[model samples]
Target: MTLTQSRRSGGRAARHALRSAPLAENVRPVRGGMTGGTLKALSDDEVLRIHKAALTVLDEIGLADAPPSGIEIMVNAGARLGDDGRLRFSPALVEDMLGKAARNITLYGREPAHDLNLSENRVHYGTAGAAVNMVDAEGRNYRHSTLQDLYDAARIADRLDNIHFLQRPMVARDLPDNLELDLNTLYACGTGTTKHIGTSITEPANAQACLDLAYAMAGGEDAFRARPFVSNSNCFVVPPLKFATESCQVMEACIRGGMPVLLLSAGMAGATAPATLAGAVVQAVAECLAGIVYVNAIQPGHPAIFGTWPFVVDLRTGAMSIGSGEQALLTAGCAQMHQFYGLPGGAAAGASDSKLPDMQAGWEQMCSNVMAGLSGLNMVYEAAGMHASLLGFCHESLILGDDIIGQALRCLKGIEVTDETLAIEAMREVCMGGPGHYLGVGETLARMETDYVYPFHGDRTSPKEWEENDKPDLIAGARARKEAILAMPCRAALNPALDREIRARFPIKL
Candidate 1:
């Protein structure tokens, strides 16, 4: 292109950016409903093969490390403690525990609007990570995350229509102690949003403290238990058949305390787990199966998410390649396994390797998100706002990803082909009786709200109009959105008296 053309394009972009950002009209939140079993990546035979293999691994290679009490509990529940000091689950034992597992589960929110029903192939998108660094949108750099930053993330998520639930996305680096960290983490998230919150704890004792805090904020014990707004995202297992003793203890404590649990098994492939995708999945399944037995033994049919989050690694560099195509396939295939067992499950997707939310991050997040949704994943954690391969979190990225997830959910909604939707009558009227186009038709006006998804920051101006208005930067738009949300008074704040009471009771860092 000549310099004149380039100059003209630049002039148009500037003019477009100067105008007020266009907001879509009649846009509403997309609710997750039963969506899949349509796109089956694994055949029935393949699914059965993986199921059998997982059971075999559990029966033969029984988990080597369970807290002694955990072993006794499982043993009492019909699991065999081999002479080798490992607890082996027989196929019958696995089947029995599977029968005892909760089939339909609901992750409750402080508010009724944010409750997530986890039955069948229903999909819900949310944040999930422990990124130490928070992305600075204006400075274009990374900084240590703090309590305020964590609160801001939850607040930002609270406003986003597509980000259904808010998990503890970033770590509070400023807090000095683990207990303080866990308590404040809950404090920040609990106050920041009324949506279902997911958080991790470092010790078993912290469970009661967190529960106490949640109960106080939620009004009382019965009220909190009735709508337990938080669930422990506990990494109960470390790797190939070894229970994380402390996290297991936390799980047991939380379950007994009437809190739901996310039985997370995050094994890194080629390092902590097998390099082959099939092998890693088999191992993850076996580990989660053991987790079920442990949970059921503690309290039969307790609410637990079947979390099998095995990450991919770059073989040559021995580093995580969370954005790779292989990672997308891993999550999709894992969702298939979740369906095989008729269990509500969650797995990681939409985390990007890029440090910045550029073109690379956009594609990386979208690929896994779309696939995970299509694969009938019940819970899609880290579906938005994650960067640097889960090492960093960005508010702007989170806002932009709301758009990405909106589009992905549209894909999941797919096509509804019924007599009314087929539009045979409308089409005949438009083509034969009226205009050739369906431009100003009744059907078009009626389906606009139900059929279409409008993006928040996406620009739809043509080159001429763009030049006439001003060129807008997508990142800047997201920054404006973040600022707008943060500027608002906390919409999900706790009662003033209760907030002060809890702060007095605990070492409230925030």
Candidate 2:
């Protein structure tokens, strides 16, 4: 069966399951507490307005140095481009394209039916950065990343509730080429965990390999095709500029193959792009929209995810610095634009330019991550241990990032309105001259789960008890968590033959 037919069948099954499933015990309605003031995130009207404005900006201001193919497509589709490379797109055209585009997707996991529901206000977190260096297991520091590092990262992500997907091999080990590296890494991840695995390969052969593996895992081409297990792929558009042929090809394959493509346009301010955040954002949006237009032209109903990682250049070194506050703000603002497009937004969070794990790392990661989460990005990558933008990956960072993501999830819990939350009966009982009626009430017990995200670390005991146990800091606690997870047995089972074949094909010679 074709991938489309499979998707239609799977969609029906998913709908049926959703209809029959009981209310999730963990998914409580947002209440009138911590998130009340911030509940009015973005209304439909506001979103439309911003979208209109963006269209106007694109048409009037236009962009330069955009890919020729992208420009030709846009021009042919009634968009006006100047000799100087400025393109003006009609709002109606942009809206039409958006309306025709697929807005919903289900990212498949190894467990057949296990999928990350995208379209809802559900937020998923993962680490970001182009290059990764370090991998830690238990308390031991694994100096350089290899295939083992990728497997270890997959293991860690599988156990963390906050991490909804795995993004490629954590570290690119020695493979014949980048494509082989991506395929092997993805195969490893697929065999290692049931969490949704995201594939980001630039080469077509690598992508085909990923699809073949995905088809096998899902039982058959029909079964794999029915669901979106291999549904999305990410590719980076050239920074502060345009799309390369490879990038375009990747987008085309994804769209034609019924996979969502997240087009990330990364630019550094004062260097590759305008020094101002707003200017950089404008350019990023234009660049991404160019890619979006191309995909829509190729396959009008293809899915697209808008993303950017525009950061400021360090004036002294003229290098892209992920630690800049401008980067975080750009992520938030682009998230708003993504909502305007009525598509899922992908952004970078939990990143630091710090050389090591320290206060700078903590602050940078927390601030940027929280900002993106609150801004309502659908999927924030780089959620775990990344340093110097992408040079290092610390297991401890992953643990700490999980905690930070928990807080971000808590923030998105808009407001609650259920009868149980009002606590009117409890209030009445207390008012009736009862001594601390709230102490042991059934309602209180039921509400406890909704009230807080139980931390995986930190002291919950009394002073004396705490003293008896070593007073461990956050890092120490994270170290302990990493140890515990690494000690756990692997979840996904590998076919011995396929495993052996993969190993033989890409053996590690140390």
Candidate closest to the true structure, highest TM-score: 1
Each candidate: RMSD to true structure? 4.6, 10.6
lDDT of residue 509 for candidate 1: 81
User: Candidate 1: where are CA atoms >4 Å away?
Assistant: 1-29
lDDT of residue 459 for candidate 1: 81
Per-prediction TM-score, please? 0.94, 0.80
lDDT of 2 by residue, 1-510 (tens): 789968866975774564344435445322111121132234556545545555666667655554566667767876787777666666676666677666766566667435655573446677545455674434544466677667777788777766667766356545547866766676667776787777677575566655665666666667765665554455546655545556666656566555566777777778877887767776777667766666777777665667766677788987658876777877777777776666766778778888666789878887877777777777777866777666778767777777666776676664467886677888987768866668656766566555656555534667864785676677778777777988998887567675665556553231
lDDT of 2 at 100: 68
lDDT of each: 0.88, 0.66
lDDT of 1 by residue, 1-510 (tens): 789989978975764563334334334324655475566767888888989999999888889878877888999999998888888999998898899999879998888878899898999899998999998867989999999999999999999878889989999999979999999999999999999999999898788898888788888888878888999999999897899998888888898888899999999889898999988888999999999999999998899999999999999998888998889888888999999899999999999999998999999999999999999899999988889888999999999999999899888888989999999999898989688888659998667656877677888878876686578889999999899999999988888888889989999988
